[model samples]
Target chain A: MITTRATTRGAAAAVLGSAIALAAGTASAQQPAQSVKLGVVSFLTGPAAGPFGIPARNAAEILIEGLNTGKVPAPYNKVGFGGAKIESKIVDEAGSTAQQVTEYRNLVQRDGVDAIVGYISSGNCLAVTPVAEELKTITVLFDCGTPRIFEEAPRKYVFRATPHATMDSVGAARYIVEKKKNITAYSGINQNYAWGQDSWRDFVLAMKTLAPKATVDKELFPKLFAGEYGAEVSALLTSKSQVIHTSFWNGDLESFIFQSSARGLPQRIPIIMTAGETAVARLGPKMPDGTIIGARGSHGAFFSPDNELNRWFRQAYVDRFGVQPTYPSYHMAQSILGLKAAWEKAAAAKNDARPSVDEVIAAFEGLEFQAPSTTIKMALGKGHQGIGDISYGTYKYNKQKGQPEIVDVVRYPAECVNPPADMTSTAWLEGGMKGAKCK
Target chain B: MTNRSTLIGALAFLVLAAAAPALPPWLISLATIAFAHALVVLGLVIMWRAGLVSFGQALYYAVGAYCVALVSRFTGITDAFVLIVLGGLAAGLLAVLVGFLLARYREIFFAMLSLAMSMILYGVLVKTEALGSTDGFNVAPATFLGYAPEGAMLNLALFWLVLVLSALAAAAIGVYFRSVAGAIAVPVRDNEIRIEFLGLSVNRLIHLKLVIAGILGGVGGALAAMTISHVDPNMAYWTTSGGFVFVTILAGAGSIAAAFVGSFAFEMLRSIAVALLPGAWQLILGSVLLITILFVPDGLGSLFMRKTRGKEGEPA
Candidate 1:
């Protein structure tokens, strides 16, 4: 009984017991009954909600549920923000930018939320940034796609958890050039707004660099929320462009797909959609097979399937919402996880006292974490912007699964698609892949 | 009795302004926007009383907003008074030019024509990159008489400015209502031929009304831009025009106070609807409108006027 093995085993057990007890004591001591209040802004009840916004809101709800209960898997485990429970106030992001601005102020000043998360529209994103700074509230922009947010303005208290739309455009163009051949001509039909115009511009610029031989033709800019594409489809058909692209999302995308599919436009030309993943569930059987699609990043159906985290997230999402997680879901998950990690880091640094806004923001700088879809790196835009690799694939309707699945997937690293930290997107693209790394 | 009513209106204005400091920022901001929108409704009320609804009042609203934005951006002008006046003038000039063609139409044709004119501006705004396209852009912070204010002070200053301007507009409109041209607008609505037979140029009178309404709409829009510090083509969209029309219908074109009351009530109800039932605000608004149309017909204004008539034994 007193042999060397027995003695060493006893000593190890004692050390483990003491360590566990100490950790428990520290956790209990650090976390009071107080909770972290978060204002969750999203298109909860609007036309945008069904496809582009509701999934994200659902993911936020489920993810926060898990976090508050300490059921989230490793790395996101432990109670919310160093053992404090998370309480969220959900606000619907309907109406105009002005309405959003007022709601944002209300959420901060009236609601007294510690932080605010969510904004699907780029216009709303641009509108809230300065106000966020003025109030010095920790704000995380979950899914606004304007690059102008970081560039052309100085930011201190604001951060974007999703890559700008430029990455999506550049990534889509690269996918086309690399995967498809015989793309003789390029054309586009985008919403007539900043997001649409910027997407079209970036795609064109990238295509010129990647596929210079592809002649440009048949460009159309339909008004946002136009709800009809018969005329636009007719123009595209008449032009007969070999390759077609669109940045339509949510209801607009569904309407376009519905209208264009009836006219058999997809079969005639190789159609690529920058934000096609949004409509996958709604247009499942209706969407034709082999339609090239992208999810803005390694999100939606075009994600890393090998990771256990991805598997868990996708399964949980489908089980809860009864639909496959779209890019919006992935984005929402990434933001919450990223925010939890940052808060934990700050809490640990402060010996488990509640972290100040500055402390949290400082902790957020250059933060990196493994997300459900991909590894998100706060690598660009002064560490206020998250960058992740882009994923693209062709839609193939799986009869057995009764859903549209992505096939022939292509992946591009964040560095390849997103501009470097020191350069703006337009400047970086203009420089012709000067420092980009692609494989 | 008229003087007493005016005094009561003044008292209400002072009380609201004084309570602003105690009220929450959200309410104050909401009030500012509601009052600004009230200006648009005031103009709509004028046209509505004449039975000439301009479905594209957003054209002038957007023009006013853009004028404020452009003047500030290009000239570095931050004075609220100067920018607002410039906004009114810019929209007024455009209205004067377009009114010639718009005044020539009536009924559905008039509404459609106005909508078309507004859409043209929307199209132009969407295509123009310098105006930030559909995303639009923000206006600089407004300063009051060379005194810069921030946060609560800024809110207070804007509130006072809006209040003073609104009261002045209401008073002036009240006077105009008592004038011959204003008095004949309703008659023109009843029978244009009769008004013409009375030696009044029906077209000329309508042209004047259009200009007046356009100027009011422009001023409202300019004030809106300052209060919100933003502008977009949505301001000129048909839906925006529809909103003004909706407020006009809900408030009725019975009195000037109705415009303010209706707009304020709409904003308050919207805020409450957004809070209690975020997705079903439109449904609630529709229900209210349906009830109003079925029961009152003349709107909330008619209700107040009814009460006054009941007490006084005649229409106030």
Candidate 2:
């Protein structure tokens, strides 16, 4: 009986000891999380996929991988966001606004994402903004160009890492007035939507302020994704405008170039496309050499800054994708970098501990960070909207290299192109661009 | 039998409402949207019973949504019930206007004309900058009887509103199915000439159905607008209409409960497909649709009816 009791006591002690050790192991494992889950949304299968969404997605993939593996250069070379690896859930954004809202809710509630970085379509951005705020999710909008997102309402959780369309139009107008001395007449052909309407309006308003002598000839508003531009081209040709401005992008931009070039519209009139940089690589020589292009900011084949970040990002992107990174890719990189900068700043403030969402958001507000293209300033929309220098250049096709290149790049300061923090883009333009601190 | 089924549906709705608080916010939102869209499918089912398929139901849907948006933007009336009623009236009025011409057509002609009308609305909305054009605009948060709620409470309130509205609509539609007008639908589908010979204007009957469908669609759109907190031109696009039609086909026209069940199932399947195959969700959805058509031609609703009939030992 004594021997049996001793054996039972030893067995119970063994079981109790193992249980204690297992509990200790679980506690250690739960103390420090190795990764943070990010919900990355972009159009994966749709018309927007090839030019804008896919490039953005590609950049996100590379950037996330780089950040996780500590392959990124310098300040952004941190091991992910504040030392936690970023595990991304890439979702497709090729659906209706309602559908996107539903998907976004799923990403936050079901997928349990820490932060959201995506949305290429302005409509989708607008739709998801309120939801993001309601959910208190840290959302960084990469490439939606609508100015109304910030101007319409103030937000705490939502931040745009790229400049809105106002910058592109204002910069294009400045480039046009400076380069083309004798501007007799100008016309615009923008899609009949908010982005198009806003772009055209800003461009026209900027022209009114800069070149008051320029006369408006013919303004045509085509439906979005209207691939056939025969009538539009005919109208442009007949109008004989010295300059033609268009904000067409993706399939519409490509289709317009093909159709307009076939009719020799570019040979007769010098065209200014604010969003032309997106199509340069694909169009190659098909895009007329003298055509003016704006990269929204200092992005794409245009004059992005020659810095270490740019050098590393451009080379890595080219190596991975067999093509140079476009403006969308740059935008995506900047958004991720912005998020990383905020996360690190918050963590540093908290003594190298994992910061909460509120802490990160507080750190992100009005935070200026370096991007491959330009220095991104959270200068507008109550420190939720980003501002960056925009550049315009003339498109050139190199025969020897067999590639499309931008030449004669003219960069505009962010303050010169974007509205002041206190004013809306429309109000600023209508007020003759008061308080514009152009250098 | 009808009373028994109605009682069962009421009991089911009560159970769902009581259980809603225990559900996650995402599931609640998803259910709200599903129930809202089910109203549109219910309208489709109404028309389907009479051998009519209005491919442009999104016309009413958009009209209803835009009405709520415009009213909220301009009038500053955040009352959910009022906005929904106004939305239904606007869409119902539009239906009355379009029904005059639409009631004369049948089959593909009816479908194409409806599509053309919705496209016209889409083009107009896309051009009208005041309404935010193709980018659309956001709708203000809704209130119930002057009681303002925010955040999760707001979501819960909206879900409850949608549930109650859906249940009421289902019950009312159930009653309509037994009435002389609703009972004449299958007869009209089988022999329009016979119905006309029986001293009834078939065109007028179809017009009534159209108006009823229009109101239902509008109510659905308004609820959806409130839930989504935004509206765009895509709401009026043919693809939106196609989705409603797809749900209708999936639900079948056998019973009213089928609309809600089918819509919920469709939404759940879509969410699952999206989660599992983000890059190829459309492919998965297409496959499911193909499978359903090949195997369950009468729709998922028929299965429920068959099961109920087996248990009750009565014809469904």
Candidate 3:
């Protein structure tokens, strides 16, 4: 026992010695200046992978490759970030927020990525935002729609290249108020998380201002990624709500649609899924007709603008991946495009030299760029959060085409849907959307 | 632990602390997290020695983490030392309360009950919207002796804090291992009746062990929250508890040093694996565990024993 104890101590000492040696040996590898390296994080191997991560990843792969080879159409056709090859280190964001924070550090410190452009989970975005500011890396958040990130605190390095949840909720409420007159009661079945909670809150608040007579009943917040919703479906069915508002995304969105449709819940009450657009292509005829769906913005199937960038992105994306690029794909594409725009603008100001992190951030702020989903305006969150026209439409599964289609698409201008830069979404909604510029 | 082992542990801590400035920010961050988690594994090792595996160590972990985050957020207490103590106390208090009910149970019952307690915390945290629900709030940056650090300096400071706390916890645990109560853990595991016949309450010993483990787990979570600068309900999830148990098994309960070494190895391996193969890192980790279990049944720590036995001309 004495010998064994001695051995343990000796072994432990040896381990510690080796750890120090290893740390000294593995100094930060020199980053190659030939290509613009980016760390792209998304859920690649979880329940979220099927609907959200995979599509977003696919879009990133094709878009980055297109940028590298300069195969993309004009404006974004500049080869990479001002003539440099685009390289990406794709990471799976399937773990805890702590894990994501660690990976974010690894990307910035060890791998020496120029910028990071991913994160579908709102929790992850929130966690990584402060870390990005600390590391002084240009991070473009593609998806994760929690408005609290910018509202809670101001950020210098972190930029969201998509509208927050407020747009989705307000747009959904506006569409409902305009289309469905004299709606007495509505219910909600959102995921019990930041994204879901904020979406429900904003929608309810917007409804209070827009349609004061509408009352909310039977608000159910099921756990996120709770695949089985037998109880939730039963509750929604019995609630007798004129409309059901939900903001469930990824697998949860599809699962709810399938289970609830099976019980004929959607047939009774029109379901307003603010994040429903991602599931439409996958669900097809399974998605109940007349279900009001929003793509979170004028994105994916709801993106109606016929522009050169959209034409090329849609075609290239379809050719690479068999399925049409969903909302996540569009969001990912727009984020990368936004980064590219900032990188190029910064480089141009420096006479085509590689711009520093601060230089790129300067170019990115309050910058308006054309995305595949129309124009993206850095209007809110002090020009760090992107806002654009958000569109909602009724789901119409075309038996003739054997694909899901969105019809009667109503687009709300960015200023109309999003709060002003100075005001929070809550304050704006409560104040009856004062100073809202609607076209 | 003997004087020599304690000296070696202190030497290890010094080496890590001195080397922190030279290491990259990522490595420093990874080491800080590894050391924090090592504290939790240290607690697990203590329980494992007594043949008591509380699968819900994350209960204390989350409690500690939430206590730090909440206290710091509400009371404007930004000091790392105070928040860590508060975290430890909160978790320790809860452990003392739960220890009474837990002392009577053994083996799977104890594991399950602990797991249930942690899940209860997880459920509550998930339902509580003010705490940010599933998307938990961020932790304010910690201050050391009223001197606040930012950027790389902050990372280095946090690393040092974690290292120092870890060293102190390890030294204290080492002393405890030499105590009469700690020395009887194996006997309690082997024959509880004999331990009871020895005029000592086995239940009380187990309860004491539970409290010690709980405090260590809480301290670990508190440090982790400060280092990561965020706290979420997942800290209390079964997976987090399982991770601590996994490290304890991998490190072995034979030596206190094994906990730190094993945890550091686990974190390093995971970071490298994730970097090398982002898609199949879990597969690589599982393979390593399978190989470790099959070849080194006692754990990575037993490999040292084998070396010592070989030198002493014991049965190969």
Candidate 4:
């Protein structure tokens, strides 16, 4: 019975192999016009919905439409991959990481999607990576900013379209050290989660290098979504640090800003926010001027808008959503464009046929392309992660107009902030930032 | 009707196991998650009968899940059965230590204490960098004995295993219900003074109930971790424990069958609510709970019972 089973399995493998070969040959012949199903995962409803998730989901919808209709600007003007249509299935990413895993499996196994995009929570992105690899589905993470996804476990089928948490912290530190040279000491208040913790560590390390004599006056890590910061603000104020760095976003960031600003924390010390761009419009007049902020990279308002891609993307997004595109929108557009570029390249390499997962992944490796926000270089970790520039700017609010805008923007090249392709974030940071290029 | 409950449970088991392969991967996963939660609900059913409601059952759940996760990471043991039992035993051991103190408290004090215990674990997990901090860590795929199933087959195997485990748990607990100690749980609730005067140690009985509930909660958490392939500090959050309590209230804690039925129904309703009204899903669930509490009183389980048989009678 064992021998028979082995022989039957061998025969089945042979049939599967030949079937793949035949399909691969005909797939090109029937190419140039097929539908590539993509599962778009982002938070649709929950506390995270208002700021982080909804914008990304909106961008996914708009970007998918653009790709399908060939409405996007040059270089990404093709109707999906190699002249095929892109049809997407949107899924909510508000629940537990486990729930997202189930959704990922559902997308690949049940719905038969060609790829998966969108995950704002670093936890969700990390949780779905192994499953994505196991399913052999190409997954381009839109936002999730954890470096662990690449350094902890590198896989072929998964790629991060945006910069990790390292860039945000390092860029913020560089801006503080170079631009805000008067500051000799600083304190931080970050959410007590992985993203917050990792950002804090990186910021501290980068600051240690950039300003070795600068002292950390105080540090506080409040629980995630712990809105009240009465005691924390008091501690930060009492510490008398010249700067206060925080990585809070969405409701958490809004609450911290409202609570701390009310108590004159911002007035007392300059605040450095790693993910404060999206909060500017909502915070409006409430957001105090001179608060340093960054959108992880040249995202949101800090992007170079003179380019064709940026102009068209920002216009199309505003026209569709009736609101200005946020940093999440930029990240989502980059992911979709990357996916399209890889699939199209693979298709071209394969003689105009639909490329297999391996072929697409091969095409994606070391692939450099232009995005609406900036030029993305897939030069990290053998092309599994994107390395690009990050911009840090000071918030300037116009109280009369009730608007908040970023000013005095300083851009840090990806090579300077992010670790080299062969090194981990901690390893790179611990090595005193060797071989980093600075402008 | 009481006598026929076993038959009903057996039939349900057969129906589910037989149809599991034909179901979609998502549904199979959904069912697995529902059944895992049902185990916690069953544990709550035991405590409810004794007039005890733990607001921190997530303590045991998280303990179980973390046990499985840690074991798999450290020892590379991926056997689902072994991991589940390890989770149960770990939780049970902790309950034994805590129950000594917990059994003496009642009502809000008991709830608060349990909640505190779970929160303590959540705090520890959130701070532990080796365990991935607040983001937690992914669990390795589980194997069945030496056989490793992948993709759809893996889902099917987990479903069948969960089905078998749930049925066995129900049967075993049903027998325990007929035991003197188990049957006394309700009377202990009705008149603790009278039962204490009747030569029974109230504290001992309560402690027993705690251990039983803890083990069941642990098993549920372990199965969920394996099914979902990820674990985080949220498992020990007060809200996670609140979900278990919600299921128990909806099920009424009358019969073991209510645990499975109510949990499955809850999952179905929640999925529908999430799909139909994304913004108001929580509002919709809250409204449904409000309506059920106001109208049904004793929950959906009471509807299946025949009132003619009076108190302590079997379900229809």
Task: Pick the DockQ winner.
Answer: 3
Q: Write the per-residue lDDT of candidate 2 for residues B1-316, one digit (tens) a residue.
A: 6787888898999999999988778878988999999999999999999998888999999999999999999999989999999999999999999999999999999999999999999999988887778789999999999999998889999999999999989988888889999999999999999999999999999999999999999999999999999999999999999999989987888889889988987787777667768888999778757756765667777765666677877743
Clashing residue pairs in candidate 4, if any? A28-A353
A272-341: candidate 2 lDDT, tens digit per residue = 9988888888788899978998778898646788888899899889999999899999999999999999
Ten contiguous residues minimizing lDDT sum, candidate 4 chain A: A23-32
Give the C-alpha miss distance for residue B148 in model 4, angstroms. 2.9
Ranking, DockQ, top scorer first = 3, 2, 4, 1
- Which residue pairs in model 3 clash with each other? none
Per TM-score, what order, best first?
3, 2, 1, 4
Candidate 1 lDDT tens digits, B1-316 = 5677688788988899788898767667777888988998998888888898889999988898889989998999999999888988988898899989999899999999999999999999888876677777778889988999987788778988999999999999989988999988899899999988889898888888888888888899988888777787878889899989988888899988888988877776665556556656678778767766766578777765666666888733
**Tens-digit lDDT track for model 3 on A280-379?**
7777788899999988788885555888888888888889877788888999999999999988999999899999989999999999998988689887
lDDT of 4 by residue, B219-307 (tens): 99999989888898989999999988888887787889989987876765665455446556677668767755765556667655534
The CAPRI-style docking tier of model 1 reads incorrect
| Location of the lowest summed lDDT over 10 successive residues in candidate 2 chain A | A23-32
Q: Candidate 1 on A125-167: residue-level lDDT in tens?
A: 7777767876789899999888877886668889887888889
Chain B TM-score of every predicted model: 0.97, 0.97, 0.97, 0.96
Share of native interface contacts recovered by each model: 0.36, 0.62, 0.54, 0.40
Between 2 and 3, whose lDDT is larger?
Answer: 2
What digit string (tens of lDDT, one per residue) describes model 4 on residues A404-428?
7678888778788888889988888
| Cα error, candidate 3, residue A219 (Å) | 1.1
